[model samples]
Target: MAALEAEIARRPGHNIKRAEQALMTAKAAVLREFELTVPQYAGMVVLSYLPGTSGAQLARICAVTPQTMATVLSNLEAKGLVTRTPSSVHQKVFVTKLTRAGNALIKRADVKAHAVEDRLVAEFSDDERRLLADLLERAIKVLNG
Candidate 1:
């Protein structure tokens, strides 16, 4: 085999993009009963854990368009999962947080998320998983830079 083919074969069976797709699919399957998109579910979970968050902050954290965040906020609001409190001083700024329902949703999602995560990294040892994550993070920083 060519050197490149040999190198490719030495790499993990599932590439990053394929693994991401599997993760999204797993999460979607888990969230199907909740009638939520992945973005909405993730946004709500973030809000639940981080109080006094803003829509702009959420957009950054979730790495999505502000327009997408707006749509997610709307959906979450409709589902009674998230709430936005207007700033008394700055009318343009809103503080976002998760409701009781949102917290509950995250708790449920966490179970399924863990299962998915375990399955995804099953082939790798704990140290390998950590090393893989660190390498991926470094690559992401370099790409973003």
Candidate 2:
């Protein structure tokens, strides 16, 4: 029990988790003003960048299951933020794009979302930021391996 406690205290992953929670909480609060959840915001961002992307592709890019992305897309559609058209090539697939309102909302929300990331790295120098990113990638690779 003592060893486990000591290991937990020494682990940096806990700090990473705490930081993630803080970042998400801050973004969620700001996004709520625009009637967006984190996943919805993510979907809008991807759609804005890659218009006509299929839901399955968006699901892969957003790292959510197809079912979850479908729910998010449904909600966005209901809000008139996006439109999904049946694909010409694939009957089962639908291509998604932002409505004008969605584009505008995503643009507005992007400012707020980026602010959170800006605030997160506000204290770091350019070199330090790059180093931190590299270190995180290395850590992720090691863990995944």
Candidate 3:
């Protein structure tokens, strides 16, 4: 504990990266069963709720680059999990929607993802959980600024 604290003191934001790596690793392990990467799962979850979302919008929501989102969408399309078409309102914009398979997969995968979230907060009280979430969001806002 002393060594970890010393390291964290020496390198601010190290713990954030460590936490992110740990969370992503655990998430990847569970999502592997569903044949989904974290970004792919994220994109699908958004599409499940907001079908016909433009790719640019999805990229921004997912916090991924447009190129990365494009690849994710392509992979999902190849898997028959999603479809992309020219937007009705904007002919040049490509919108994405989950297919039946994508919807079903996200339903199944969401349970596993929630399990990871539950495990992450298992030791925290509800208030603590909320506080932690709020703190992370605040950090993101500050960093974005």
Per lDDT, the best of the predicted structures is 2
Candidate 3 per-residue lDDT, tens place, 13-131, comes to 88788888899999999999999999999999999889999889999999999999999999999999998989888888998889999999999999998799889999799999989
**How would you encode candidate 2's per-residue C-alpha lDDT over 108-127 as one tens digit per residue?**
99999999999989989999
Q: How much lDDT does each candidate structure score?
A: 0.82, 0.95, 0.92
Supply the TM-score for candidate 3: 0.90
| Residue 94 shift from truth in candidate 1, angstroms | 1.3
Better of 1 and 2 by TM-score: 2
Writing each residue's lDDT as its tens digit, candidate 1 over 28-145 gives 8877877877888778778867877888899999989989998899888888888889977689888988888888887887777667767879989999999999999887998789
Question: What 10-residue stretch in candidate 1 is worst by lDDT?
Answer: 9-18
Give each model a TM-score. 0.83, 0.90, 0.90
- What ranges in model 2 sit over 4 Å off? 1-6
Candidate 2, lDDT over the whole model: 0.95
TM-score of 2: 0.90
Clashing pairs in 2: none
Worst 10 residues of 3 by lDDT: 7-16
